[model samples]
Target: MAVPHYAYLKMKLLGPKGLIIVVGDYCKSLECAQAGAKLAESLVIAEEQRQLDRIVALANETPAVPALAKEPAGEASFQPSKETKKVKLKPEDPSCSKYVIVGTRLDNK
Candidate 1:
């Protein structure tokens, strides 16, 4: 009788300061290991996205326009011109744009 070779998968979820947040279960198969790795990666990415969302929400919550000061009579106030220029995006141009793959994980464990 031949003995079956077993593989072990270990994953460590780390924080900004190299602190371990969570530890994954040890997988006996390659497929399970890959799934564990993917899940861990997704968790990290989701946390990052959540933080980004909070920052964006905070930024957008504030008013962009500032209050204008009251001026005296016969005095000119400086006003900025609101001229908008249209921008064209070309997807086929390799130099102008590139494709990015987000939240993709490759596991070799």
Candidate 2:
């Protein structure tokens, strides 16, 4: 017997445990096959995004440890031993004229 002109599209929806939940073994048209594949792809992408969001939320909810708490016992206090040299900017400098810094340190703190 001669095969039909229409191609067959086999689709299987798998669960997290690798178990098959839904199957579509026969599709009459190319459009239907493509639509089914696109739908499955979108669903997989959405599920992955949801899982990522859940992981991020769990990480955010976890309590963060203080920087000092992680230090070993008998460690000296944190301090910069070397003095930092001050950089003076000239008004006539070409690079300085291109940008302006207006914010105060208090605003940042």
lDDT leader: 1
Best by TM-score: 2
For model 2, how does the per-residue alpha-carbon lDDT over 23-57 read when each residue is reduced to its tens digit?
23453465777999999999999999999999889
Q: State the lDDT of candidate 1 residue by residue for 1-109, as single tens digits.
A: 2222233233455557874533334443657878899999999999999999998898799877767887875538654335433333555675775454322232424
lDDT minimum window of 10 residues, candidate 1: 1-10
TM-score of 2: 0.34
Per-model TM against the reference: 0.31, 0.34
Runs of candidate 2 with Cα error greater than 4 angstroms are 1-28, 64-109
